[model samples]
Target: MPKKRQYQHLKSFKPIAPVSPALSSSSSRGSDSNAPAKGVNELLSGLRRSAAGSSSASSPHLLANGPSVHPDLRSILQIPDTPPPAPRRPVRTRFDASGRRLPAGPPPPRSWVTTRGQDVDLSHRMRGLKLKDAPSDHNALPGAYLPGRGSLIDRVLRAIASDWEFQRAYQQYHLYFLPNHLKPALLRHIGISGGGVTLADLKLILLPPTDLYEQGELEADSHTTNEVSYLDLSRSLGRSIRLRDVTNFLVPPAPQVHDTHLEDSWDAAVDATPSPPRALLPNLTHLSLALSPDDAEGGSWRHLLDFASKTSHITHLSLAYWPDPCLAPRAQTSKVTTPQGNKIYYGGTNFYSHSLDHDWSEALLVLRKLSRCFYELEYLDLTGCGSWFKALMLETEHDHVDWAVHWGKVTDLRLYAGFPRQEDMAAAEQVAFAEVMETAALVERHIRHMRAGKGRFINVERDRPAT
Candidate 1:
């Protein structure tokens, strides 16, 4: 059962009326103090409405149309008008895992490659620029082909001209016209079986007359024959041939005399014969001769001397005689006695010997004649000439032979032959051989002493090749 007590306190409570609002101290003390004061009920009711609107705006559906908050309260509450920026995602990339950039469009097609040894095989493929052929329907233009064709032609022509092997063969073995009669011998001598000869080889093996007028006159007077003549040489080997080297190739045999008296006087007459006044091969420079003393009845040397005397432009001269005392002395030299008038003898086994003094004097005469001819000689190689060359140098040292008239540009002089035969010399002959070699060594020393301070490339040596 429910108790109905506690009505005693409610019976005493009576209804009370609302009170008016009190004025502020500033307003009450103002000159408009008599103005009416607002009731507190109106202020209380306005505040109640604002509180109720705030609570309703908290709902998500009402937030879009919510009432504006007070300016002072909005700043305190830190309300944001704009929404937060959307979270940023990583930028998409076009690069692969290996860091190489992928293509923006479709991948290119693979290219087929061929190698020289493969003969146009298409097994290998790669990516590159493609070469396309021109259309066959287009008519060829002259100037259009000229640019590419001319450039290619120019490259080929330049390569052909600059090729060393081709140029050397052309310059060294270029063909020339030759006379039919003399062509066989000349070709055989030059080791060529061809009908013609080269300018380089012809100059060394043939001799042309010094004067063109004399050649022309000789040609007009003479009839065609089977012999080689100065006119034949001039006609075949032109003046364009430059005579640089005069070796043993062109040495002619001594003139033959059928008459007995002429044969008796031939030696003196040939030695006294003067050299030609006019020179041959004005640009002739090198003279290399290796001959025996008994060649062509001992008159072959005269031809070499005559050839040398005509040229004053010789810069390199090498004269070598066979059978020196240090070389094959026993075969060439003998102590056998012979008649005074009969100096040469065809003894047993084709052996001949004159007095050693006579042989020395003959070699001296050749050296003297050659010394008087050349002035521009730079290299003098007297190797294998025996001790006679040393005697000539000794004469020059003693003022008997002219030194300044012959030598000025001689920077290289080779005297002694580099051979091991000296070690095999008998003790009895070795003493004399050493003495003779020492005399030759003095010449090399004297040259070095004189040309010491001139700052030249002095290559004066006794034994060449460092023997």
Candidate 2:
């Protein structure tokens, strides 16, 4: 055991004040309390003043000669003749990192704190799948993305190693449909040194539906640079373009290019000149359009029709879920009263009456115009088109199309209507004999008219078998 240290003497010890020897000697002769203290104070003030006035390099004899401070007191009250210099901290040198001060070498291994004992880089592990501009396979389209690398055997081995690891590896690659930022780059790539892709030889183009795509921050700059137009497509097609799905892709280009200078005068001239009013797709053969009655009024459909005029050589046409053009009302009319005091005019199919023999005049008129537009049409598919097939078959008063005269080259036609059960049809016919009988008679006549031409194939499908 260690012994405790002693501090007992410190408790009773008395401190002594320094007094001048002369004053002390005089005080010893006749003891006076205040006089000795007053003398010592005077002497101390005189020494301090004299020491401050004298130079630092002066001899030590000046202080000895000046005040008769006793040797014992002098040692005790030893103030330095000159004040010491102010203390300074040492400066650490810093090298400029912007300009390399040291020889180039490999970067030091990342700290344990940074790596956290993980094999994969922290940033790489944290990163999510991002859409890439170019595909891993150069042969694939701009939007195509293949997740895994290597052959089937390699992939299978990887899958066997770890199911989660395989899934994570597969999730790294992503594809976005025709992003706004990528459009300009894709066009340049195709027009310039694009490998395996050529404008002249490019045949099929399948664009994603509007709902499936990511437009991605289409600001003024991006819009100007990346906006793909109908004109651009036409030029890129170069007479070989077919099977184009222009559902959401056909947009008119920006009128003016901002913040750019033209080096080539020919390019400037081309921009200045307006596009000629003619069929945009003169050689387009296979056309597919999915339009609703609401979109029929839009300028997009009109612009498309301008491209696909009578001059267009479209053969195969597919109208998926196309609206009934005849049922669409062109204009809204105000309520009107007849002279007989009965309200007659409002809008739409309400204008026609049951008393008057019903003729599908509006639908037939529209259909006739469309047939004339696509006069070279051979095959037509109207799948999921509501009441359009019925309208096509129904008789009209005027502007009737002779199936032989209009679609001379027609070989195949596919139509889809609801599957009305044979028993239900029979029951409906019995209940509404007059209406069903008339419709049945007209359907028989139209079927005969359509099938009159040899080598023509027409197949109408239902949701399910009517039997």
Candidate 3:
């Protein structure tokens, strides 16, 4: 029985149920008291009433928020209705002098004043040579005929009459003795005879034979020792000839006989007669002497220098000899007096004492004397001389270290065959050659104020490197 009671007590029980909304709503509808509607239609009607109330209450709020819908929209609305116009610049004027303009008037023409302080027609003068008459075959005929059959004597006499014409014609027609073929003809044409002609005139003699003489060929000797066989043709030509041609004959080895006996014989033949009074070539601008090795042995250069001292106007001089030091004796004395009253004294040992110490000094004395006496020298060609000259001229140890200073005015120099062997065609030697060229250029540019073509060393063949 207890088990049965316990089982019935343990059994589950259901709770009381709540009333349904539909039933409540039906009750409310039926009662019609002051309660809200509960059906779908009433609910809809209540929502509509609430919506209408909400709309009425929020109408003012919507209007207040409507104006500020978005920040971008407000900025767009506030933008200016019209844009601003661009600025303008002022215009420039034409006639103002402040602005850059072309020159007002034409420029002055190029001009230069003449030496005579006159406004000469420079352009007209610069204009090329005007043809007096068109150069025709007829115009050249007279010049062509004059060379062969014209009377040269008559022309010379006529030229002598007019000094200006003579000077101009002399400068133009006083031909140099450059052609070998013309030498004998000229010498023959100008007969050798004793006249009032001085050696100065003889210096002007343009005997073509002298050019031949330079080429180691001379006409057969017509003179003998006892009598004057060959005429003094040089004197005759000197009277009428210009001295310019003598420069060519003054080249090295003139009267090129080597034998002293023969030289003496030739000298005697030329001046056989004991003439009372004869003028030496005082205006001799150029002179060359070829001394033999034998002649240089007995201090013969002193005698030669003595003879040279006589020629007061010898401006350019060249002394060349075969490779023989003895040919140019180096002698110095404390007191050396010439027959012409020119006295020289050596303060030191004589140059030709056969001592190496005084070699250069002695050579310098000779060169100094020559340069001092011949101040008008323009060119000095020392091609074949021995080292004695160079030792004196180039050595810097002596007091007269600047041996070539006197020759500063000389414009042209020809040094061939005798340059130091080591200096031949070397880069270092180029400086020495350049120095020489510089000196020449300075003279030509400043002193002479003229341009001239200078010779340069040209290698005949490529120099091969030593193995």
Better of 1 and 3 by TM-score: 1
Ranking by lDDT: 2, 1, 3
lDDT of 1 at 360: 40
- Give all candidates' CA lDDT scores: 0.44, 0.44, 0.39
Each candidate's clash count: 0, 0, 5
Candidate 2 residue pairs that clash = none
TM-score of 3: 0.27
Q: Which is the leading candidate under lDDT?
A: 2
| Greater-TM-score candidate between 2 and 3 | 2
TM of each candidate vs. truth: 0.33, 0.35, 0.27
The sequence of per-residue lDDT tens digits that candidate 2 reaches over residues 1-467 is 99999987677556778899999888877765454556888889989888976754364545444546565775788944433344565653344458646445544467953566564665444432211322233222122222344546323423332342333235222212334333333332332222222322222122223343458532322323123221112112222232233321232233553545556676454445555433323334554442332233221333345545533566766564554453334433446688889875464443342224464565566667767778887766564444445566756666655466676566555554322325546764445433433444454357566667553554433233224
lDDT string for model 1 (1-467, tens) is: 99977766566556766543454555556845776776799879989999988886664545545566766787899875433344566666778799999868653454322334253333222111111221121111111111132245433323332352354356432222233233323322222112123444554333333343454665553322324322112111112222222322343334554543454564565544444333333334544442323331211344455666555666776554433222223334343446665454222111222233333433445556666677677776665555454545444232333444456577777666433445677886666556546767777666556556663555755642224
Name the lDDT value of residue 103 in candidate 3.
49
Best by TM-score: 2
Better of 1 and 2 by lDDT: 2
Query: Considering summed lDDT, which 10 consecutive residues are worst modelled in model 2?
Result: 229-238
